[model samples]
Target: MTPSEYEHEPIRGLPGDLPPGERILWQGGPEWRTFARSALHTRWVGLYFAAMAVLALLSGSMGGLLAAAASAAAVTGLLSLFAVLVARTTVYTITNRRVVLRVGVALQKCINLPLAVIGSAELRPLTGGHGDIVLVPNAVHRLGYAMLWPHARPLKIGRPQPMLRALPDAVNVAEVLARACGAIAPIAREDAPAIRPAALPAQGVAA
Candidate 1:
């Protein structure tokens, strides 16, 4: 039988039914190819192996060259497969009231970030209108980098920022999110290289 891990979700990518007034603004999953290239660093990995293979060839050892080539192919294949699995299992939901992420391969979990708790959003535009949206929660909420791997902003271990990675037509999605947040609260616009992000009011942490 075909596997159905999310069959139990009352609404796709959500842990439970939305409150009466809440409604989804947008819903999507990562574009797997883009996800592999960005999150898995597939291109970089392939280039490294290619460089090694070239160096091995220059050393005048056919065996070494073949070994390097094989290693590169094997590693790239594995990373690509891993990316596919992650992309397949992940779903991102943008509701009028919150952002929800359903992610994980072996073990799955849902992360809900209320609009009121989000401090700011940053858009990192990629080729072909695909991009990443990084969400920084306010002081009231704390999130772990490890727990949100591949879905967390890279090199942000100090303060993890939840990310919606490899989204197709990211600009449109960002606009949807901005509008949703803006409807509930005042939003400050921030300029980005490509699309702008909506910066919401910061919520204070309890003492």
Candidate 2:
């Protein structure tokens, strides 16, 4: 469904108040919410744990199996725990004025882009291995990052183009952004922007 068709609701966990002269245009959690059903990492982790559990149950060397399972379980548990922490800590906040992408557990890394400075937004979904949204700027900039997630749409405004990843409803987030920016329509793209191999930065880590 389009953002226009969906009702506007305050984010369940956020405060309702906004500073004077500022208004929230759009706010969303991770795209993982919507695409959880299809997340391969999640599936892989689940399968690993399930297999270990079954091995522990059926093996004659139950003690050894239990120890092995425990080690695997510890690692998997830590990975899942970190994922949840990252998802909870990361936030995408858009206002009439600018877009903010913040990531952190304690200390934070924030990338902000003003709507007025944006040339355009390109939405490209990754194909094959795992679906992802890649946002590119019309001009070269520092935020030329391609974010991977189950359901997210990359957005480009100005320098330091912030991307939202693993969101539940990324298309909805994009629609809300387009509405806030007063864009007539979303830009549809067949492929991600080609960049020089030397210029590409490190890919963002999956949550």
Candidate 3:
């Protein structure tokens, strides 16, 4: 509970009154080891559960091999604790016009997206610098891929494109959201590296 404690506690993801100029250019979250190696691949499922726990310790005389090495160390510690609880309850915002998503671990809310219904955006980086920013809303924006899992866009069909997952630098936060959506869409990619949105760190998801 800190992104300045959702700033004032009304908590509908805090845009109850930001209309005079529409400020808030960026908020941040994710990067729990880049959402556990690109949205819970969890380092290739913990390297295939540590190579099946070293082949169940070389088949240790096999009697179900110590329960298959304790079930591959309990499924690699429950997928690294669900990617550190989805990077500590997730949150990604960028408000010059809109793009909020407070996401859920179980039942959390907030999922606005309005840069005039975002027709296109894509920035996938993912290696160590971490990245993802795939919003493609237009056609009356519906959204629902399990309501944006790990932010979403792994499978595409009709819609479901809201994403901002695992952003560390994320190409400078997608170049500060492509210079705030470049006056209503031209963010075709400008390669970000420097627009320090006040050095981020609104408390949480840093380690």
Clashes of each: 0, 10, 0
**How do these models rank on TM-score, best leading?**
1, 2, 3
lDDT of each residue in 1-207, candidate 2, tens digit only: 112211232442233444577677776555333233233365576677677777777776677677767876776666566566556665678786566665544444555556554455543333222222333444455653333222233232333444455555444555555555553113322333222122222232111
Candidate 3, residues 1-207: lDDT per residue as tens digits?
334434454534563667787777778888776676677676676667566657767766464566656776777678777777767777687877778887776666678887756655767677777777777765566667887776888877556787888788777767667567655544433332222233332321121
RMSD of every prediction: 6.5, 11.1, 14.3
- The lDDT per prediction is 0.79, 0.48, 0.67
- Model 1 poorest ten-residue lDDT run: 198-207
- Give me candidate 1's TM-score against the actual structure: 0.87
Per-residue CA lDDT of candidate 1, range 1-207, in tens?
A: 114556588888888888998888899989989999998999999999888889889999899899988998899899888888888889999987889999988788888888766767887788788989888776555678888998999998988889999999887777777777666665422322121233322221111
Model 3 scores what on Cα lDDT? 0.67
TM-score of each: 0.87, 0.51, 0.38
lDDT of 1: 0.79
Best by lDDT: 1
- Residue 16 lDDT (model 3): 60
* Shift of residue 183 alpha carbon in model 1, Å: 1.1
Off by over 4 Å in 3: 1-4, 15-19, 23-45, 48-54, 57-59, 71-77, 97-122, 125-163, 166-176, 179-181, 184-207
